[model samples]
Target: MATGNETQVREFIFLGFFSLPNNPVVLFLAFLAAYLAIVTGNLMILVLVLVDSCLHSPMYFFLSHLSCLDICISTVILPKILVNFLRRRNTISYKQCLAQTFFLIGFAGCEPALMAVMAYDRYAAICRPLHYSLLMSKRMCIYLASAAWVWGFLDSAIHAALASQLSFCGVNEIPHIFCDVPPLLKIACSDTSVNELANHITSLFVGLFPVLFILLSYVCILASVLRIRSGSSRRKAFSTCTSHVIVVILCLGNGFLNYNRPSAGYSLEIDTLVSAMFCIVAPVLNPLIYSLRNKEVKGAFRKVLNKWTG
Candidate 1:
């Protein structure tokens, strides 16, 4: 039985990217290309990390997990959007909406935690070179990866539980392309003070906290790099950290803009574009960033390719 405050929302109508005057064929082709790139790029990273013995380190291990997260995140949002584009219908069932939101939050939250772990890996490599292997052993890497997934799982569970508690009397249209927390909450008939507050607090802890930790790790890393007597060594260290920093900025910037807010007067257009940056662009860029910037990953890719071709 539905509670007094809990009313079943049968389906949500997605007011997608078509609100703009762009050509549907062009939009569909562009997103299709992007989706293909993200999947292929992340999949290649995962395969390279798994098959190449040279890439079997804490950093690549974390990268593999991050690639997995990205693939899942893109899959959760992009497929439904593609279907909507093809069929010209934006309807999604209530259960499907909640499920997509759950996985989206889970994988999205997992990303920063994985980045933080990678930062720690770099710190161990640069700051404690002698103890690097001891600190970031296979068991430790497994534990860190597991912990990131577990954290994401718990966070998503809380968000979904909170969302399930809300009542949606009417206005089933979701303003954004995807089923996100803030956009969905905007259409709720019941007072969403608790849900909004919880979303804000969780966003702070999940979004800001990992970013601060990554920044702190980089600070220590920078100090260590400065102390290195060789100029070449300093440049190398800086180059390695740059890729991670770029990804951190992209993830946190879009994330803060999307989740860290009250739903009042939110612009749907701006939100969709920002969400695309993280959901679509970030995943595609991550492997490319690391491949182009990190010599080890580049070398590993070459060696793998050469062996396959030979």
Candidate 2:
């Protein structure tokens, strides 16, 4: 160990999936399969949203963005993970590590905010139907989506800057699969109090705030649904948003669990597993969750399928 914080940080060694058996080839193959699934699923969602005129609405628009974010988040994680596992190559340059941290957090931040936007769209669609068109016009949707992406980038950029500037004397092995903020902070020799504070502040706004907003939106939606006199209308309203609700729960729940923790409670094995869920499994399931559960999406997908196969 280089004492006294003398050495400048250069690179990091990721102790990837340390709990897994010592079988890099098998691990790599599994990760590759998962990565392909994530890509194919999200891409399918994107295509359906684009081609199906029936889906040319605010909900599908938001979903298209969500699918894009899923693809981005997974791409940032899985390829590198698959490659490293294959070659048993865990070393990442300082630049590469910081870039990974920046992109993944950026996309992760976007997800909750995007979900909140989708929630608002649902609220308008259910709670205020007369005003839905006026309230969620194309321009308004653009604004909300842009706001989500911008805030996410800004929040993550702040964290990335702080983490990259920290002094690292010697310890370079990252205890997790990726360069997430908590683990990166763990190995830093410099003081991280301010950095931790920044992380918590950003995490609060982008993560917790959006979750609360989504919950509040859904509560209002539930009340509106109850007020609807027709049973069929209520069922249709609920069906429209069920997939999004599930997606919100998975994305925000994992985010809250992963980031809103003290370093004192850090566990490498647990972190790796959680990262796997958030970075890989969630993205792969998003399209399936939305398509398989929603009647409209299934109908649209079938049309698209028949057009190709017929």
lDDT of each: 0.83, 0.87
What's the lDDT for residue 112 in model 1?
Answer: 78
- Could you tell me which residue pairs clash in candidate 2? none
User: On residues 34-109, what C-alpha lDDT tens digit does candidate 1 reach at each position?
Assistant: 9999999999899999998888888888889988988999899888878877887778888899999999999888
* TM-scores, one per candidate: 0.93, 0.95
TM-score of 1: 0.93
For residues 121-218, could you state the per-residue lDDT of candidate 2 as single tens digits?
99999899999999999999999999999989999899988887787787789888888888888888888999989976887898878889998999
In model 1, the worst 10-residue window by lDDT is: 1-10
Clashes of each: 0, 0
- Give the runs in model 2 whose Cα sits over 4 Å from its true position: 1-5, 261-267
Candidate 2 to truth, TM: 0.95
> Candidate 1 local accuracy as lDDT?
0.83
